[model samples]
Target: MNIQKMKELIDKLSQASRAYYDEDKPIMSDKQYDALYDELAALENSTGIIMAGSPTQKVQGSVSEAFEKVRHSEPMLSAQKTKDVNEVVSFAGGREVNVSWKLDGLTLVLIYDGGTLQKALTRGNGEFGEDVTANARMISNIPLTIPYKERVELRGECLISWKAFDEVNTDGEYSAARNLAAGSIRQLDPMVTKSRKLSFIPFKLISPARTTKSEDLKWLASLGFDVVENINAASNLKEVIKQFAPEKYDYPVDGVIIEYNDNQYARSLGTTGHHPNSIIALKWADETYETQLTGIELNPTRTGMVSLKAVFKGVDAGGAILTKATLHNVDYMKNLQLGVGDTITVYRANMVIPAIDDNLTRSDTYELPKTCPCCGEPLEIRLAETAHFLWCTNKECPAKQVRKFSYFVSRPAMNILGLSDKILEKFLSLGLIKDFSDIYELSMHKDQIVSLDGFGEKSYLKLIDAIEKSKDVEFSHFITSMAIPNVGTSSAKTIAAHFSTYEDFRNAAVNDDFDFTELTDFGGTVADNIYNWFADKKNVEEFDKVKSHVNIIYPEKKQTNANFEGKTVVVTGKLVNFTRDGITKELENMGAKVSGSVSKKTSFLIVGADAGSKLKKAEELGIPVISEEAFKNMI
Candidate 1:
């Protein structure tokens, strides 16, 4: 063995791992990656030398700087993977094993205390992880509180379904469910995660040692978790795989995980440097088929970066026939040596995202378009810190403005009713909406809008009414309408409550020496975003223009609860009279800090139906518990 190829494989795999985990981007197919990995394993065995920082030795992924990193109580290790069903059967060796979908999304370790969800962490390199507690709370399927008390730790995949992916990714922004799910769950703002409709499906119980993995799943499900679907592999790997196959799942699953059913036996088997000995992943490589590339499609994004997509002859992947696959960047396209009419292999990563595996023809004949397809403007090559991407520098590109217009009409923003992305696109194409301010002037094109498909006189009138109604939006809504990065409804409301008016908010960002980071939960990056957005001439002009059209109504804070001022309150359980957001806003308005968990600092705990652990904790801590009606009376 040269060992030179071994070193080279390590480097290549390391790079690919970084791209996939740190960047949330995959540069190669699962099959190709696995083959390289297996080859690396063979080389390592032959040479008896595992290089430092080798992908084989350690669990991959970088801890996000946006989150607080914490060491796990027990290391969340990786698993030994194989594509062969016989290998899985051999691993089983007649002993019962639990087979489940190896979900292709971000893994989270959720910690519960006193029957209430307390914390959640991402599997960052297994030994340590990022704190994603707030974001985890937003997952739709995960219960806030469960029946079983005592401290417990559960491991699960935080995912967005293909259906939810379709709903959220209106502009083809994300190519796959895993990509969107990971991105959404790792968001700094939980509201963003909430909007995406992520679900946490528990695959393993990390705490309170049970009889078997199957027992753990049953217990977790009883505790209100959407447990991962599983079946008993009782000396029958083939039958087990059939139930846990790629085509059988709704969410993304790259493979099936088989773990020993006997907990004590599995524990005795012990773990390797990177994975456990008792568990293995039968990697179901995405269905690959040969196809011919037809052409490349380019889409310009709000950030000015252009996305390159390869259109190929339709081929069946996992069951669905997909023709288009994202090239990611020009570097990827060039690496594949992809050209028009070139014979290429296509497969869907995670059984949903169509991706090119390799170029069979090796034509290397494709040329970068001289101009952006959308704007017909010369494309600029942006030199990023690590990579280069094509940019459409044209500021007035319709593709760029579509995002802004969509944001402007969103419910939390302008509250403009009946305006969808498709309708906005139609408006952009017809030149009815050029800028944010033009949304207010939509009444001018009423006759034209009425004539468009799916538009009747009643619908046009309703739209016009909405546009007129939006002019009377509150200051918070107006601020949210700007679509500044990381500035969602809550942050915007904070800014609005401080500034009191659109003019004051605008001036603070540009004209005055104002520190947005001084606000509650507002970080330095958010402050910088406000400053940088204001610095832009186009942003300033558009903001002011839109501001002129809208009546900036600052909500009057009717503070009836004088004693509640500066108090720390925690609201728990389901309330019929008010939603969580409603109660939180009300508390905040009365100068109280609304904490998520019950603590010694908590001055009051508002109890609702199924108050659960928080109420119990409050009682134990001697914290005051009040009924919803009692809190309402205080309000």
Candidate 2:
């Protein structure tokens, strides 16, 4: 076993785990993670080198500081996972095993004292967890008082039903129910969790144990806990699993958990640090469907970077027809050796996002475009620290301009309402819009605008009114409209505070007098971006042109230290009185840095109605959560 290769695999796997479990941003698919883990395990077996922090040795988990930490009565080990049904059959070894849905949600330990629900904790690093009693009390199905609850530790999956997920995620913000459920359960405020409509389904009874696994579940069910669906795995495991397909159930399930029915016999099998020998998780292989690759679509972004997407004949998998999947980066495409017209297999990753499982054809004949698909500018491959991406050599590619213009008029920037992407593209193609200034001059083409499809006298008037109204913009928002690299809402607010007007900030960058690096979170890379953006002759001209048409209002920043001074605040949900961007800018003016997501580092979270995952994360982290009304009073 190569030690260097092992180290690299370990690091990559660890990072991916953290990305999914901690950050809620998954970088790789389940197949990719399984492959890496299998390789590491094989290496460890051959070399006898179980390196420190190897995921194979320890159950993967991270303890968030948002809740009160509690030590588990006994370590909650992970189940050894397998896709093969034969392995599960072998593990049973003729003894009757109880097979149940391996619910795809956060594993939670619910504690009850005096026949009343007292505490709830997540499986944080197996032995330690944060107390989430308040939220657990609000679970729709969880009984506040159970008959058998005499200081009992009940283990179960906290789940959000597919129906609930679909209803709550009307905006399609969350990709899976399991994630949304986990987020909902970990909330600091029980009310936030209650509204998400989560449920607890018990799988095991830790203290005051029953004779059999089936008996424990039955008892829990009788006590009003929604125990996981189960069946007797009497050597017909495959047939049983087939009957209980994931789609039939409203709750999300990744696989089935099979274990011995007799509690004493199962306990005698012992355990590794990572998993118990008694229980095994039978994961269903991602159901992939074959399709013919038709072509490759090169999607160019506003920054002139191009991304690859496989355009294939649509195939139905898990009820959704899939036509395309991301090729990820140049390295991934190269490994697949994908070519146009090649045979490919695609599947829904986690039964949600479409992903390419494999490429059967090894033609390696795919010809990456040498010119930008939009502008025909000579393309170049740029290698970043992580991956290589194809880039349009010309900065003034029409695709880039269209995307840039679309962004400039977006809510975070100028907050223009009527200019949709299609409208902007049409306007650009017709020479109605040339630059940021041209957006304001759209009124000049009134006769032409009203004549187009999807446009009329009322709509044209609305568009013009929106464009005119966008002129009285916040200075920070106006700065964001410029689309300055590295200068987003937060940085724009910082820069806005440094100077009174757009001209002072513009001239400071143009003349190289003020140091942007001195500002909060403005590193050398950010400062360099400001200088480079101003250095562009075209950008300078566009800035002056747009400046002449709009009124940039620099809000009065609080000079004295405020309650939120140097604090990190996150706003979520639909506010009663303020827009998302409005509240964020308001917080910035009050001397706080506004973040889009919540983490342990966040000082507080300001929420309104229908707050989503960020609000849940804030609760889990034990961060100070304030309502919009409460926030108003504080201000």
Candidate 3:
């Protein structure tokens, strides 16, 4: 309660906040920080002594004057957090409570007037924020216009989905999704924001707070806002923890937020300089599994980058069996001093992906592979952004070709079902399939294919049928399946939109007349990649052969349909009423743009049984997911 102690607490908390928010690193756990904050607040209250720089007295944020600053109507204080489940139960106090994921992203405030979005700002220093209205408008899920005409202010988290982070991070520049989201929203150019696919999930209504917290979230959803997902009347802390299993959620959630359902009672308790007493954050303790590293596997990707994977003793982590973890690149390997026969500790990052937490024995004996596994070509180290990776310098390495072919038949590319990588490898070994065009000619080897191990008559017939069905592909699908460097599904869609027909695109690429950099995210590198890919005589000839057997359906001219115009949609799992292509065509017909992955811009996720990562990602982003029957009804 003394002024000296208050100053100490203030300095410590401020340092932690700066590291967590600005540096994307944490010096203290959420629990440790919250406990210290609470002690500081209690001391100030009891002794009637508050330091000028106390964390509780003001919002904890650094002001970046790069953008215009806007003062917040009300201070956006941090939430009190705890590691103990007992504290959460005590905080709930037998009252109905809503427990939701504490999304690890940058905080944003949105202002609306006359049912139209007016302004958007970052939670800079709590009292004021940097104006990012232009960038906010570009986010797909942040509704430009809501049903309510009255002036309203909302608080939310601006985040990049894990799926989006991986796609946009083609060069592996960013370390985490939160960091990517932070940097993306702060970009001065709104075009950058659009390219990154940042999304906003509103968690609190700052103005006209007339309804209970639970009711408010429902009303927000009704008004076309993507409200944060939560479970109402969660019985206990254990129940909330069960629901918030890290592996089940697609986005990065550091903890869980538990708040009283009754908004009035929560407000009555008041708040300190740091956090409100009404709500608390429960941070899950990371569970680590110790295992011995047996060996390392170098896996070549489509881009010729060889990723080092740690092969260790199998560990059951959070119900999933994990025996291998990604070493990322050479830099990570050197940092860990990884070696065979070394003891290592592994844990699921966010309870999902297996990650090596620590190497207890820094044996430092693991040697980097000198040659590519598939083609025995000499490997070279390349520096990309901040990381160093092992790459196959040989452009014609069979390993790279195999990965490229595998990607070509992936769901996001050609949607060629039943052609597993093992099957592709077999076909390649037998010289039955040489290039993209050879996939279509697979039917010619039906007798040979059926005679192969694991290839029965029924499976062979099914593979042929799938390949034949894939022949009727769209321009975007065909372009994406080509495995052009730096060109993904989104970029392919953009290219397809600009050049309606395959012939037009090919001609433009050949002549280098079109300005591809003018597209949303396309740059000189992408343009160069496109031109170079087409300029190769072999590629051109192979593409011509592939183009002969398939029908390329050019994109339809933009049609203004009220139902789903300007909407971005993702279809995942299985559908009863529509095939993947059929639903995609239907969505396109209704003016919806179909995306291969789920992102913040995704308006709706059409999900069915056994929905995978996309469905979980949709739930995390609070994007509306419609069932097959519901989709039929809407159409």
TM-score for candidate 1: 0.71
Which candidate ranks first by TM-score, i.e. highest?
Answer: 1
**Tens-place lDDT digits, model 1, residues 533-570:** 89998899998898788788897865747868899888
Model 1 is weakest, by summed lDDT over 10 consecutive residues, at: 381-390
- State the displacement of the C-alpha of residue 299, model 3, in Å, after optimal TM-score superposition: 3.0
Candidate 2 lDDT (Cα, 0 to 1): 0.79
Better of 1 and 3 by TM-score: 1
Error of 1 at 513 (Å): 13
TM-score of each: 0.71, 0.56, 0.69
Q: Model 3, residue 341: displacement in angstroms?
A: 2.1
lDDT per residue, candidate 3, 31-135, as tens digits? Answer: 446668889989989998877878776767776768998888988788876778888888888888888888878999999999999999999888888899988
Summing lDDT over every window of 10 consecutive residues in candidate 2, give the lowest-scoring window.
167-176
Using lDDT, give the best candidate's number: 1
Task: Give stretches of model 1 more than 4 Å off.
Answer: 42-54, 62-69, 112-119, 131-151, 167-175, 183-197, 222-224, 235-237, 245-250, 316-319, 383-387, 406-432, 437-481, 487-635
Among all windows of ten consecutive residues in candidate 3, which has the lowest summed lDDT? 23-32
